[model samples]
Target: MAGDGTIEKVSIIISKGSLEGVYPGLIMANGARAEGIEANLFFTFFGLDAIHERRWERVRLATVGNPGLHLPTWVGALPGVSALMTRYMARRMDRLDIPPVPEFVEMIADTGAGLYACQASVDLFGYRREDFIGQVKDIITVGEFYDLAAGGQIIFT
Candidate 1:
């Protein structure tokens, strides 16, 4: 439980390896921080792409195998399709007044939220420390992350 103070601790577990999943975790963590909550995000599996320097710029929208995806799987699999779709979606989201992922990430980092990439996932996926973005706090073990989550409201996004 959080202390009886002004700040509230919120732990968020990001497990999905998709562009859609990554943004929500970041947005929520940042939003919580904006409200003076102590936000912490644990990135696991494909979600690590959001933190990886090499992969962050190349993060693609999941058009295939995503039940909520409006585009067909074949279209998503087509070369340049995902990129085009991502751009289109970004434009559409902009029209709807939604901020881009990079901006959201900057906002989250600016709010001083703790951002951790899963060490086990990094090793399993062959990612190095140099591969991650500069804002990442550390590559933490699952046990360590859970230790932080204990007694806090944990949400999987």
Candidate 2:
């Protein structure tokens, strides 16, 4: 609380790698920063792909098993559905003037927000420090994330 029950900071934990999963956290963190709140993004588990050097741009919208698609699971599971949805969403975002993932990450970093990769996940995924994009501040443990998140709200996306 920032002296009147308003949030002053936020720690966003991203655990999903799908395009839909990663963007919410990014948008939230960016919104937090826009509101003058301190924001930190902690990428772990599959979320690691969002910050990965080789995987970020390739992340696809998860149509399969996603009820939000409002389609039968089998339909979503069909070949080319995910890619089509991903392209549609990407075009929509571009129309809305939203930057692509890499540029968005850089934009957020330029605003002084902290971006971190989970150390455990990095090791489990066999990723070196250099495997992340330049915007990632560091690979940190959960405890370290907690430390950075002190006196803030924690949002798991």
Candidate 3:
């Protein structure tokens, strides 16, 4: 906490691949930066897709097993449900002037927030450093993430 009882820094861990999963952390980090708070985003597990060179543009909203959609599991399990929902959400976001995932990532990076990929996840996914977008500061281990996130609030999204 800062002298005014506000957080001085924030470290967000993103572990899911869906649009909903990835965007919250992005928005949080962006908001934190806009508020003059130091922010760092740690990408791990499926969340790596958001920073992946090829997958970022294809990251979709997960409709299946997502109770927030207020739809039955069977309905969400339909072949085209996820795609349809993703398209709908994308249009909604666009109408709100929110950029796409890649552009949003770039925007956040431009704010000087540290963007990192988890080493364990990268190795498990057999992803090379070249596989990540240029905005990634580095692929670091959990220990390194903790070190970098020191004196900051840690949030898992």
- Cα shift from native, residue 84, model 3 (Å): 0.8
For the record, the alpha-carbon RMSD of candidate 1 to the native fold, in angstroms, is 2.5
Ranking by lDDT: 3, 2, 1
Return the TM-score for each candidate structure: 0.86, 0.96, 0.97
Clashing residue pair totals per candidate (backbone < 3 A)? 0, 0, 0
Query: What lDDT would candidate 3 get against the real structure?
Result: 0.96
RMSD, every candidate, angstroms: 2.5, 0.9, 0.8
The number of the candidate with the highest lDDT is: 3
**Candidate 2, clashing residue pairs?**
none
Please list the residue runs of candidate 2 whose C-alpha ends up more than 4 Å from where it truly belongs after superposition.
none
Q: Write the per-residue lDDT of candidate 3 for residues 1-157, one digit (tens) a residue.
A: 8778899999999999999999999999999999999999999999999999999999998988898999998999899999999999999999999999999999999999999999999999999999999999999999999998898899999
The C-alpha lDDT values of all candidates are 0.80, 0.93, 0.96
lDDT of 1 by residue, 15-104 (tens): 875668887887789778878888899989988877777666666678876667766678778888778878877889899777676666
Q: Residue 39: error of model 3 in Å?
A: 0.7
Worst 10 residues of 2 by lDDT: 98-107
Model 1 regions lying over 4 Å from their true place:
1-7
